[model samples]
Target: MKKSISVLAATLFLLIMVSSASAARFSIGGFGGLNLPIAQDDASSGALFGAKGRILLLPFLGLEPNFCFAKYGGKDVDDVRGKSYTQEGGDITSFGADLVFGSMSSMGKMRVYGLAGLNSNTYKREKLEDESGLGVAFGTGFEFFPQEMLSLEIRAKYHAIKVGDGGKVHLEFSGGLNYYFGTE
Candidate 1:
């Protein structure tokens, strides 16, 4: 886990350094929204929050580095005797990078983009041991620029992680704001 994080950090640093020279635009943003579990009986829907930075390496390609935290909702279950119990929820902390493909120049004030990424996720629960896993994520988003320096954005993403012999999958819907740092 430590080694993976170290490598991810080094790669991000190198990308940022390279982007400083050839990138046409840069932005930083924060987001919050819903985290909905898919086909999972042990957990329910919860919340998600994150921060991200983007570097446009070309007119149609960009890179995003991000960190996020998400929570699972507790589930209510019944034993064979028909007694009910509430299961404890879990949370995940993730760090990843995405390759974004889109035209920076927009039609009117809006731009549409798609992204795919790899992430390292740390999952924690009340009674279970903490586990770390590598995950994949894919998403699409709309960005609305209200002014030269600010953008309003909304996105929907699918994330999947494998742990032990099973896996977890979720859908994340989010809204955010970004402040640009370079010429767009």
Candidate 2:
């Protein structure tokens, strides 16, 4: 009985070490693209940029922390007596986390992934007070690896923010490159 227990413990330790060594390492990257306003015709699409860090726990699973900033196209605000006045638009900043599902292709050079997560958005308006809300985010993207430590990816994300009168959603499309380090 004692011998069996020792053998089992040794086997478990080996498995853990092997798994850790084989796991994919953490990666940090930044992306920039378009942020389009959806459902609300009042706002126009503009530039968007963000940064994110990814921790891949397994070949098919990862956790990502993200930060993004976006601008809305400028437009005239509160025209008094139809007189030309000021241009007003809003900017948005978002912080979020996502769970990513990924796998390599049959040939093993490319990786495709999908992500879903929750985000908090702060809306800074030109003529109004700032408002903040929590929203749901989901997206899909594909990565192509040209080397062991570098890759390129393009992704599209849909974020829906809850408000007093129902809610609004934004659709963002972006592309970026990443450098991976540490693990295989």
Candidate 3:
């Protein structure tokens, strides 16, 4: 019995080490693209930009932390005659984390990820004041490494939230390059 227990413990330890060794990566990247607002009274699609840092826990899994800023113009606010119009616009900032999955291969890395985080939006129109909410984000992208030290990727994300009576959902997308300053 004692011998069996010892063998089991050693086997488990070995397996853990091997798995850890197979799934380790770290990267930093940035993105910029467009945000298309849906089911909203203002703004069509806006420009967005952001940065991110990632740490791979397993070769196929990683944790990514990112922040984005976006601005849109085209909503109507309170007019000169004390009437509200829908011709004004606004800016929004989002900070979030994503549990990333997919393989990093020599042909380039492909990933599908889910995001959960917070967002703060400020509107230029008085009727659409600033608001904040806990949001859910999901997106996918790929990285192509032309050089060992640099990579490029383009991704699209969906951000949605339920706030009081004015909930919002938007499609966010970006394309950016990354520079790996440290050793691989």
Candidate 4:
């Protein structure tokens, strides 16, 4: 945990310093979202949340790297005849990157954009087994500005986590805050 915190802090500090000196286009931000899982023969839909940081490469475009922590809520059903079955809600952890294509107002106020990314997910079950899978995702969202240096956004993504047997599809929704450092 200490190592993760240190990495986050260092990255934020670097972003602040770079954004403060360079064009206003450079900024850093974090986000959290909910996850919904599909096609888990033993599990139900659940919630997911995450955070990210971005560096603007152009006035209207940027590269974002993100980390997401998610949980799937589910229940199991059993048949009679003295037999018991297990159904469970699982927890997932994911990490990935997104190439963000969006446009902000000329004054750096409100913005709207789309994103595509590659992600990996790990699923955990109690007293059972764990699985890891790779996924592709795409989503879109809008950011609203209340201050020149800060804004809020809501985004969503569709994910396909695996191919072939026991594959799953997931949809997630999230919201976050962003800070713009300089001028455009």
Candidate 5:
């Protein structure tokens, strides 16, 4: 926990320093949504929440550091021996950076973008050891800036964690509000 806190603090400081100097565009936001599991027969839909720091390097390019947590819904099943078993939901936490493309639509009130990045993911399950590994994440989003410094955003994200023989793939649909600082 201490190590994670330290890394988060350092990352925030670096982002602030870089953004302050550039004075281009900087924002902080948080989101929550549904985490839907695909191809993983044993897993079910879950709750997802996350936060991000966004730094726009150019009008059409940006960098985002994000953290997310998702919890799976519970399931019950019986083994091959016909023994009943209660299966609890699982959870995952991920931290990562993304490269974003596109921004500020022609209408001037909307921003649409796509992001892809690498993440450090940790998976936890009931009655099982926790697993940690690297993953890839990709997402698309649209934000509407109704006010000068505020935006309402909607996004869908996909993650592929390399843990099992192949990988664990999941998708998340979410909404958030962001507060921007600095100039355009």
Candidate 6:
């Protein structure tokens, strides 16, 4: 895990250094939405919030660094004897970076994009040991620019994380606003 994080940091640093020379635009945004656990019996749908920053490296490619916090809803489980018990939900805090590719042109008011990224996630829950793992995410979204310096965006992403011998998977749908800095 340490080695992987080091490599990721180095690669991001290199990309930023190379792209900074020609980067034309930058933006920062915050989003909030629903987080739905997929095929999981111990968890239910919850809420997620995050912040992200975008650096345009080319006309159709950009880099985004992001942080997110998500909650899992508690579930009611039935025991072997038909007794019911409550399974408490957990929380995940993630930090990651994404490569965004799409049509980002000034000629249109709307831009569509696809993104893939990797992240480090920390999981915390009651009665279980806390753990950290690596996660992967891929998604697609669109941005609508209603003004020269502002954009309204909506996205849907699939996120998966490795846990102790198993894994957790979820889908996130979010909406946000971005404020652009420099020429768009």
Most accurate candidate by lDDT: 6
* Candidate 3 runs further than 4 Å off: 1-24, 76-86, 105-129, 181-184
Candidate 4 C-alpha lDDT tens digits along 1-184 = 3354455456545654664464446556777767777655566667666767776756666667678887777666667477766567778787766667877434656678999876666767788677777667899988888987888989888877763255767788888888776566
- Candidate 5 stretches with Cα past 4 Å from truth are 1-20, 78-84, 104-107
User: Higher-lDDT candidate among 1 and 3?
Assistant: 1
Instruction: Identify the leading candidate in terms of TM-score.
Output: 6
Q: In candidate 6, what are the lDDT values of residues 22-70, reduced to their tens digit?
A: 8878899999999999999999989999999999988888999899999
lDDT digits (tens) for residues 1-184 of candidate 5: 3464466557656765775676566789999999998877678899999999888766777778889998887766767598866578799998877777896323378888998876778889978998877778899999998987899999998988876556889998999999988666
Q: Superpose all Cα atoms of candidate 3 onto the true structure and report the RMSD in Å to 1 decimal.
A: 10.8
Higher-lDDT candidate of 2 and 4? 2
Instruction: Tell me the TM-score of each prediction against the true structure.
Output: 0.93, 0.78, 0.70, 0.74, 0.84, 0.94
Which lDDT value does model 4 have at 12? Answer: 47
2 or 3: which has the higher TM-score? 2
Cα shift from native, residue 55, model 4 (Å): 1.2
- What pairs collide in candidate 3? 23-58, 23-59, 75-86, 75-87, 75-88, 76-85, 76-86, 76-87, 76-88
Ranking by TM-score: 6, 1, 5, 2, 4, 3
lDDT of each: 0.88, 0.74, 0.64, 0.70, 0.81, 0.90
Q: Which digits, one per residue and each the tens of the lDDT, describe model 3 over residues 86-178?
A: 665577776656666777433344334444333333334356656655556777776777777678877777787554456678888888987
Q: How does model 1 fare in lDDT? A: 0.88
Error of 2 at 155 (Å): 0.4
Sort by lDDT, best first. Answer: 6, 1, 5, 2, 4, 3
Better of 2 and 6 by TM-score: 6
Instruction: Show how many residue pairs clash in every candidate, following the order shown.
Output: 0, 0, 9, 4, 0, 0
Candidate 1, TM-score vs. the true structure? 0.93
CA lDDT of 178 in candidate 4?
81
Candidate 2, run of 10 with poorest lDDT: 1-10
Worst 10 residues of 5 by lDDT: 1-10
Q: What tens-digit string does per-residue lDDT give for candidate 2 at 1-184? A: 2353355345434544654565558678999999888856457788999998776667677767688998877655455787754455588887767778877322366888899876667778876887777667889988887887778889999888765456768899999888787764
